[model samples]
Target: MTSADGKGPVVVKEGSDALLPCSLSTEENIEGKLFHWKKDGQKEVFLYDAGVHYNNGRPGQDEQFKGRVSHFQDGLKHRNASITIRNTKLADRGNYTCDFPRLQNQTFHIELDVGAAAEPSVTILDQIKDWALLQCLVRGASPMPKVEWKDSSGNMVPAHEPQVSQRGDGTYDVTLQAAVNKTDRFRCVVTQEEIYHQIYAETNVLLPPPPEND
Candidate 1:
């Protein structure tokens, strides 16, 4: 593949679609040609032979990618063979190859990096006389998010060091706890800067009033 398109990994947020680009460097139309796309050089992501495709009931697509991969049919005449993966998952992150086995065995490579899944749930764990203990937890997120607690006014609230663990599926689970001295609407903000994605969940903490004076 030509270096005209600088080599950089395609960044996509988890659960969103990702476009892996590939095309004929010679700008030769490939509408009636055959090309193959594979993941990590193993999984059959998609394949197009002549006018038929794996998505068009051609079959033979890897089970993990079935019904989730698509190609740009209109771009075929422009030498484009790019494919898009819908509802991306962390397991889908890997190196991909676009191959034209018939034409001098021409091949191109692309890297895909699926970002973290955003969705942190906040809940009240415990409440004392004047303070309430709140917990925020994020599960099944990749590349571990920067979890934090903030008040309704957006000021950061002090919290215990986040407890992080990895799941069997290679995703992460993070838990953070904070003690708020006053009743307020608190939020747990989850940020994955690499993908420029941020999400948050909030909860209201209402501490009972102090005991009445004698």
Candidate 2:
């Protein structure tokens, strides 16, 4: 799909194949055209043109990207020279450019983050003797994220003590406090709609009671 803005870098998950969309405003016959894909400072990793794969005919692709690279068929229709990299690896993280032979040059840069998916944690702590403190934590998220608290009924519970704070490491920590009740089920929802495409992670926690000995 087209990017939200006309220009910028796109971020994708590691280990998963990503499609970088590129559209040209110029009208030209891209059929039987030569398409080349390569990293910014690297040689051509894959090439296709004249309805055939040229990388195999030429010097061949790099040993690292032997069978992991392919051109997007539909991309040629709208002047989209996107490439699909299968089984993406951490080393594949870098900028990419698509060169159209005898047509035009287009560059699309991407950043791939390879690591474990974010893990969300919910903690219930008692504060002010009667208020229940619900904390939601997510690690390794860029651009921050939106946090919300909801009850079992799927209704948004009003929270007066909700705070969003940034950790020293640049991660995010959200805290929402509400009156504690034995029957209330509080859920901490962490969403990064833009990057993750949905709620990255969430957790449900129950408020515990004070110690009887106290």
Candidate 3:
């Protein structure tokens, strides 16, 4: 119903179906009413009129949404107007609005965050003394995610500033560095706050063997 943050957007896995919830708490019958759904600046994501789904509405529905949008019609009496978008894509990452014009404050909105981030990985960029210099990478996630490091104890580990860049595909690549002591097992975690989507990778960092002396 809600994410851990409560304020974060609803996170959904890439290529997976996503639901944008909207319900009128009061008695609202939308049988023939113009119940509309849309993303900002985009064509109608879905429309209900004359007891028919207008996902194929004229004026050209966005091709990306064809045949993948649906609503809960059975709950019309209960005012359940939730919609599901199947096989969601990165482009679906944004705010959505669903509303009933006949009622005041009937506009319900939600955000969809999609995560297709490749497997997270850690590389030993360098090492010094008891600290093993580590580099963590989170590749290709939409809405851009924040990366953090944690120790085996689940405590937040100290990490240097992270370097994040956007790829041509509109996803993001994030790299961060941490110094893990020999006794530490560190994990690199990436999270998309809007949807609260997260993925993590772990690595055991051991102190490098002492330099050989001739």
Candidate 4:
């Protein structure tokens, strides 16, 4: 990857879209030319032949990117050759090279990093004497997120370590149990360390109803 100008790698969430940066110089007064985007020793990320995008089992194209790649036509006139990758995959992580035929210094090399899921579903499990057991679970994440319990004051709560399990699809499934005092609002936060992404689910301990005045 180029990594030039302190352009760090782009982090994209899985199952979402990603943009690969590239452009040609309009100062060159070029009419139209071929552009190519390919993965390192893997396959062609995208192929533009004389302003036409080729696919449908066309040569020099990879199946992984066949229906997922598209360009911004209006930007093309402004020397923009960037492509968008829809529904990103974990396998999409790596280097991507964008080049224009016969154009000098018109290549953009970028590295893509796929982030994991960070939303956890939380619920009140059981209410015991003075406290309740809260359960939180998040699935379909890579590298397993850190599941934790926090109070409304932003203080970490003492909770059991989450039970982490790997799914058949190569993702992770995690469950954490926490005990919370009634009348307190608690949050279950799941953090993906790779991208420093954090998402949380909130729940509250229900206080007992007041007695009726007779």
**In lDDT terms, which candidate is top?**
1
- Candidate-wise lDDT, in order: 0.88, 0.58, 0.76, 0.78
Best by TM-score: 1
Segments in model 1 whose C-alpha atoms lie over 4 Å from true places? 1-4, 56-59, 208-214
Model 4: per-residue Cα lDDT over 1-214, one tens digit each: 5532237787778888988877654544222777788887467888776656765345666888878898877776676777899999888888888877576646667888776676689999899767789999898787578888999998998998779889876679999998876578899988887766788999879867546899
lDDT of 1 by residue, 1-214 (tens): 3221466888888889998988897757898999999988899999999999987779789999999999999999999999889999888988889999999999888888897766899889988789999999999887788999999999999999999999887678999999998878998999988788899999998887777999
Clashes of each: 0, 0, 1, 0
- Can you give the TM-score per candidate against the true fold? 0.84, 0.59, 0.68, 0.69
Model 3 poorest ten-residue lDDT run? 1-10
- Angstrom error at residue 102, model 1: 2.8
Q: Report model 4's TM-score to 2 decimal places.
A: 0.69
Candidate 1 — what's its lDDT? 0.88
Q: Global lDDT for candidate 3?
A: 0.76
- Compose the digit string of candidate 3's lDDT tens values, residues 1-214: 2322245577787888897877765666766666778886466788776576665444445677888888887878677787889998888877787867766646766777776755678888877786788899877867677888998888998899989899887788888998777666888888776555677888877776666999
Better of 1 and 4 by TM-score: 1
Rank candidates by TM-score, best first: 1, 4, 3, 2
lDDT of 2 by residue, 26-121 (tens): 744454777667765585667777667744466667777777776667657766556677776646655666666567455444443332234566
